[model samples]
Target: MLLGVIGDDFTGSSDIANNLKKAGMSVGMYSGVPDNKIKLNKYNAVVIALKTRTIPIKKAISESIKALEWLKSKKCKKIIFKYCSTFDSTKKGNIGPVIDAIMKNLNVDFTIACPSFPDAGRILYQGHMFVNGVPLNESGMENHPLTPMTDHNLVRWLNYQTKGKVDLINSLTIKEGAKSIKKRITELKKSNVKYAITDTLDNQDFDLICSGTDNLKFLTGGSGIALGLPKVFKKKGMLKKSNSKLPNVKGNTIILSGSCSLTTNEQVELYKKSNPSLFISPEELIKNKNYHNEIIEWILRNSKKRPLIYSTTLPKKVSLYQKKFGSNISSKIENLFQKIIKNIYKYNFNKIVCAGGETSGAIVKALMIKELQIGEEISAGVPVMWEPEKNIKITLKSGNFGQKDFFSRALKKL
Candidate 1:
């Protein structure tokens, strides 16, 4: 493989894979660290999707390093540790710690830290991350059920997560273009900086960041930076036109969401209007271990505009569930969704749409889906994937990525 990407979650894996495939490189996305027995064929880019975004720091570091070693075995020359564009994390993070572990395992001194995706309303400026023109702390991410981004200043946030020094390359220097940014990175390395967060305002900033870091063995950022790497690889004759086509899947469609983000709450409400929707609550989930049977029954009853099953509720109710059911409420809900998805798959629902990072990861792993063929984009940072052998079409959406009507729009895409 020319490039190996370690994504923090399943939806993130799809995001980078979608971008690389659009750049005309064949991409294969895996659910988690592949077993040694599984065969991984040569691809332009291989993304190992891991569900470590909100996990414990030590576990995240261990899993990320394992992924790094696996990618190295594939003889990948370059690696990108992809995280959310919103820089979703707590003070103790899987982001900073995983990056630190990867750098240590690879024996690299300096690497870039950028979590900017301008097209999706995520940008970093003056070393602080922003969402939709608002500082990250003020954004809805601050209220995230897990890994609330309470600090907007990435320099301070990252510093809390790692013992090494974290610095910044401001946007003013970036506007001067790639050469200037390159000079700044060289100076930072000379001063013994381990991680430097680069400020990005738009696509032009992404271009400069990519150019400045292309020679480095490791790059850490969102899927947006992966967009810039393809051009560099193409210039070096490492890319080819790929059959990244969306297969026509004809079957009953089902939309499932397990995210409690503010955006996903809005999407669930909008989708409920035109579709038969069922809300899954923690009480119902914990009380009834066979709660998925209710979901299967509901889908069978109302199969008209696709069945939408969501665990997305308001922040207050989410807090109540977490308080009442304990901290494992999220895992319980994910296990419930996994059962529901497994039961529904027996009916052969070809088109499956998942709306959260952890939820998507659980579903993919439960299905034992090892590799997926990259397909067309349903929205920014979201794509429809194809399991060629089983003839199943799946769409994985990041929690805060799509618009209000994303659920309905994604259905029309298939």
Candidate 2:
């Protein structure tokens, strides 16, 4: 099977390609366009990774089909259009046209799948795999490289969920129920509902973020900055000066991120759960020699004077609502967002580092209730975040921040 990746914005395209190659797939990777053509006979599957923000709705639609036409010209039958879920926190830019282009022009026989649920299925394109809309059981692929799509089997997997559950969606007149699982986001604010969110290449929302408030009491995890970044900072060094209005490292501050299954509200619950997954460890994260406490303990012991926090943890779904949807989720999910806003004082110590635009954006959203002034994020990551929000200063960095064994060549600024 042949695989091709397009686009490089935010390091998303690379993320998918790397994941696929790790699975032992023969994948060809490229960034941007201008070359316009590839020998299709050499490959079976093609992925077009476009940054929805840079390419507007119209351009995305037109160029997406242009890509498909090029792929078809190469006699390639299977084409996958993948997009990154990340962008500036402002939520500007729309790729619906890209999806719409696929839906409208794609051959009925052509298989398509959104990159969501990356862990549940085979990533024919990246993390999970799929072919002709069918997910391959990676384990079973050795014997049956191509699994026949039986009607019943297809039906079964469509509604499949973790464990012994199925997300069956029936025709009209059938509604599902959610009686037991409860949401706790209401405590955050009015946004309690969690819904999958998408960004369109529009500047209105970003304008709102930039215009709404300033002088924000920013809060974020070290991972978003310390671990998630370092791509761009690799060259400049840790203490390099930036043009952003806000300070890169908030002195004597410690922010936590990670724990994918956790949510924003759940993050606050870190102090309550006693299990401490926000700044601590989960079952899977503790396997390393550090046991997920390397930075946490270090900070508690050695961070009495350090100004900037260099720790990280992935975000997780804390409450039931965050588990089902995500930040893009609705009021039932977002309500918990307000909790962060009102509870800002709980973390007010020195400075802040709302890392990861998404997490930082949420913090900004929460603080809006109080009229806080937030500094802007400075863009600079090597692979990821090449372009960040304008007006606001962000320290952009590549996704592989902590990967480097030593300091970067540009650390002379320190």
Candidate 3:
């Protein structure tokens, strides 16, 4: 593989994979770490999708190291560690340890700390990340249930979380062009700076970043950076026109959501107006043993027009669940969604829409979907995936992406 990516979540995995596919490199997106059964020869790039974005630090580090090892075994020359555009993480981070572990294993001296996705309304300036034109702290991400991003300054946030000194590559320095940026990076490395928080406001800034970090063994950022790497690789004759193919899929459709992001909540509300919506509360998932069978029956009863099974709600309810069921309530909900997905496969639902990174990861794992053929996009940062062997099509959407009517639109296209 020319480039291997390790995404912190399934939706983020698809985000980077989408950009790589758009840039003309055939890509394979797998849920969690791939085992010996997976084949790596068909694609130039493979993204290992892991649901470790908000997990415990030790677990995250272990899983990330395993993923890095798999990518190395595939003979990948360069690797990218993909995270959310919002830079979602607590002070005790899974992000920090995961990045630290990856860099240590690769013996990488330094890597970029960029979480900017311009098209997704996420930008970084002066080493501080902004979301939808607001400082990330003012953005809805600050209210995230698991990893509330209360800090907007990427340098400070990463400095506290990472293992080494973190420095900033401000936007002004980036605008000076690739040569200047490369010189700055070299200087930082000499100063023993282990992590450099790069500032990016637009595509031009990202272009300079990709150029400056051309020789680095690792790059860390949001999915938007994937857009810049294809040009770099194409010049090296390491990429080709992506002829992604998939078999036609026609069967019942289902929408499953486990995100509590503001956007996803809005999307669930809008989709509920036209379709049968089943809400699985954390209490019902963890406390009620019969909830699974009940929800499954509900899904079967309303198989037409595609039913939606969601654990999505407002941030307040999420906090309540966390208080009542503990902080790992999200994990319980993910496990619940996986059980629902695994059981519903027998119902012949071929086209599935999974919203939220954790939910997408769970669905893919529960389905044992080893590989996917990249297909047409359902929306920005979201694409329709086709599993050839199972003849099933799935669309994975990050919590903060897509329009309010995304569910209806995706179903219409499918």
Candidate 4:
């Protein structure tokens, strides 16, 4: 593979894979670290999606390194450590620790840390992350059930988890273009900075960041960092125009959402107005071992209407449930969705739309889907993925991605 990417979660994996595909690179997305026997030579890039975003630090580091080693073995020219544009993580993170581990494994001291995706309303300025013109801490991300982003300053947030020094490369220098950014990187390295959080304001800034880091062995950021990478390879005569088509997938569709993000909550409400929707309560999920069966029956009865089975409640209810059942309530809900997907797929439901990172990760792993062909995008940072052998097409949407009509819009695209 020409490029290899390690994503911290399934939704973000599909997000980056979608960007690469749109940029004219054939991309394959995997649910987890693939077996060594699987062939990967046909694609320009391969994304190994791991459910490590909210995981314990040690396990996240271990899994990320294993994925890194596998990619290195494939002779990948460059590696990207992809994370969410929201800079989603706790004070003790899988992001910083995983980056530290990968940097050590690669024996590289300096890399960039940018989580700016302008199209998705995520931008960075002065080393602090913003969502929709609001600081990250003030954004709805601060109430994220799992990895609440209470800090907006990337330098301070990442520094808490990494042993190495973390610094910033502000937008003022970036506006001077790639050469200026490169010069700043050299200065930071001389000062022994291990990671530099680059500030980005718009889509054009992505080009500058990619050009400046073009020669680095590894790059770390959100999907936006990938916007300029395929062109870099093409300039070196390493790219080809590969097919980015999808099989016309027609079948019974289902919407499964487990996100409590503000956007997803709005999407769920908008979708519920016209579709057959069933809300999965966390209390019932923990109390009823056979809860999935009821959900399956409802889906079957409402199959023609494209049923939506969601655990997407308001933040207060989510907090109440978490307080009553502990933090694992989200995990329990995700497992419930997994059971629903596994059961419903047997009934000829081939087109699946999943919302939320953890929910998408659980369902894909349960299905044992090893590889996916990247297809047409449904929205910015969201695309329809095809598992041709299984005759299934899926679109994994990040909780914070897409507009109020996203759920309905995604089904039509599928």
| Candidate 4 residue-wise lDDT, 1-414, digit = tens | 799999999999999999998887888998788888888777889999999998788999899998999999999999999999988898887888889889989989899998899999999999989899999999988888788889899999999989899999999999998899999999999999999999999988988888888979988999998888898898889987787578797789999998889999999988888778999977787888888898899899998889998988878888898889997888878778888889989988999999999899998988888889888888899999999778899999999999889987898889
Q: What does candidate 2's lDDT look like per residue over 1-414, in tens digits?
A: 222233323234434433333222333333233145444333223334343434455775676566556655555423445443221111123333344455456433112122222222212222223422454332322121012222222223322311112221111101111111111112111332111121111222222221111111110111111111112222323222222222333323333322122122233343324322334323223245443345444444534332222223332223333354443332322233234323432433223333322333333344431111112212222221111121111121222222221112111111
Q: lDDT for each of the candidates?
A: 0.86, 0.29, 0.87, 0.90
Tell me the number of clashing residue pairs for each predicted model. 0, 78, 0, 0
Clashing residue pairs in candidate 3 (N, C-alpha, C atoms within 3 angstroms): none
Give me the displacement of residue 276 in model 3, in angstroms: 1.4
Worst 10 residues of 3 by lDDT: 239-248
Greater TM-score among 2 and 3 belongs to 3
Task: Give the 10-residue window scoring lowest on summed lDDT in candidate 1.
Answer: 34-43
Q: Cα lDDT of model 3 overall?
A: 0.87
- The local lDDT score (0 to 100) that residue 110 gets in candidate 4 is 92
**Model 1 TM-score?**
0.96
For 1-414, candidate 1 gives per-residue lDDT tens digits of: 789999999998899898888767788888777777766564788999998998888888888888999999989989999999888888877888888889888899899888898889999989988899999999988888887889899999989988788999999888887888889988998888889999988877877787878779999999988778888888788786686466688888889898888899899988888778998877887888667887788887776568999898877788888899998998888888888888878876778999989899998887888778887788888988988767778989998889898987788887
Clashing pairs in 4: none
lDDT score, candidate 1, position 204: 77
Q: How much is 383 displaced in model 1, in angstroms?
A: 0.6
Q: Per-residue error at 345 for model 4, in Å?
A: 0.8
In model 1, the Cα lDDT at residue 252 comes to 80
Candidate number achieving the greatest TM-score relative to the actual structure:
4
**Per-residue lDDT for 34 in model 3?**
74
